[model samples]
Target: MKSTVADEMCTEDLGNVLPSVYKSVRLSVASPPLLHVNASLLLLTDEALSEVFGAVVEDSEEYQTLKVLRKGGITSILFSRPHHANVLDMKMVEELTTALHSARLDPTTRLTVTAATGRVYCGGHKPGLDAASGLQLRDGLHSLVKCVLEFPKPLAALVMGPCVGVLAGLLPLYDVVLAAKGACFQTTVVESGETPCGCCTYTYPRLMGHARAAHMLLLGHELECGEAQRSGLVTEVLPTTAFHHTALSTLHPLTATPPPALSHTKQLMRQPLLNPLTSVHGSAIMTNTTQVISMARYFAAGVKRNSDNAP
Candidate 1:
């Protein structure tokens, strides 16, 4: 069957390419053992953890913003443009959406992991968000989030640094969010006086409670690795040591679970949320696009006035 455990799980152990995130923290903290250490992600040929330093890549093609690495039952989508802090521009968002859709259709794919290069997981929306590009950005992000919400296979995020704005809000929605000890999360939509998109208003409150969600979105309160974990956002916090091996090891258990079980469970759990989140994303996109674009114009004008006065 498509969901057979043997057919869906990773074939090899994960200790080869990755490193430990926190050397002092034990992987076996929970009673039942949170990590099984059997999974390895073909994130990169080398799993080049140093790529987390933001290697400068000249943007050239459709693959510039991110790259896809596939092996066995797992597909890893790495945000490749660390030089830009892995910002989800229209291209990035749309590309990600396409990748998710592809993964959903691929019978061989049992899992999809989204990891970022450099110090940031996702730097948020486009930097120069303006009225002209607002609709495009909104549409792209709306599509991306919708893909994630409906993804049948397991979805994981390898977060290393600052997970901000739209992505900060997205962590709560992923099946697993593995974070480095230094990773931080912050929702910035309200900071710009924009409505929260990516189903954040609906999801965050459900995961962490309304007060905490309001604190995060309304006040832009940042949650460090510990806080995020305590608040139930992160699945695991890793030490900063083993670059690739240690982090990927936690996913070994994914290979143990039957594919159908995971898929069915996810569908069942997310079924109730599907409609609400879809509705929220649609309505929020309209408000988010317009309000954020207007705010961007205001900030730009303010910057111009300050610059002119300086001269």
Candidate 2:
């Protein structure tokens, strides 16, 4: 088979890069294990772990918002623009959509993970762009959300900090969400005078129940890591010190599973949501696009007023 971008990116053998990390620890069922060392320490030292995870396979050439990293059977899409707190701009959305589509087509890819490298996972859409730009932004975001929803492989998120706005809205789409102690989640669309996009209207209620989903979407309630896990929005919460190791452990299981079986299982599990998700997706995009255009006007007018009043 011809190598796709994902296949090309993941060509480096992880086994060669970190031999010690790839070795399995032996445990005897009947007797105490010979080694008394900490299991976490045996996997990889922090420095080695960082080298493995932080290795960038594809830098943002067209899309400055994120980078793609591949190791073993896993492909990680990291939101790279921490300067804007990894905010989702139109360009970012388009880039993400293209990446997702590429991953979908790659047979070598078994699992996909989305993460952020800053204090925020995603800060929602950028503001103050023109109405036409806002519409393009909506279209781009809608396509990205659709890609995530219909992704064949299991998708996971490692949230290390505050996950706000559209990023929070995407939690339910992920098969698993590992959050750090400092991580928090909020859906800000309704509070911002916009309806929820990303099929959040359907996904949230299914994952967290109508009441809690209502609290988040309608009342703008922010869930701390503990609350998010309790509400079923987060799969696990780890201390900042342990978050990376724990996230690796969580995704390690999927590497063992056959890709075709895992993909089919994911498809079966998401089958129930597909119809409703499709039904709501179009309207959600339309409503959000209209609201974005209007909100842009409001933001521009406020900026003009401030400028006029100054000095």
TM-score of each: 0.75, 0.78
Off by over 4 Å in 2: 1-56, 296-311
123-151 per-residue lDDT for model 1 (tens digits)? 66664456667766777777777788778
Residues 1-60, model 2: lDDT tens digits: 554333222232222222131111111110121122232222122233346475545644
What lDDT would candidate 2 get against the real structure?
0.69
Q: In candidate 2, list every pair of residues with a backbone clash.
A: none
Give the distance in Å from residue 105's predicted Cα in candidate 1 to where it truly belongs: 1.5
Kindly provide the TM-score of model 1 when superposed on the true structure, using C-alpha atoms: 0.75
Q: Give the TM-score of candidate 2.
A: 0.78
Best candidate, TM-score: 2
Task: Score each candidate by Cα lDDT.
Answer: 0.67, 0.69
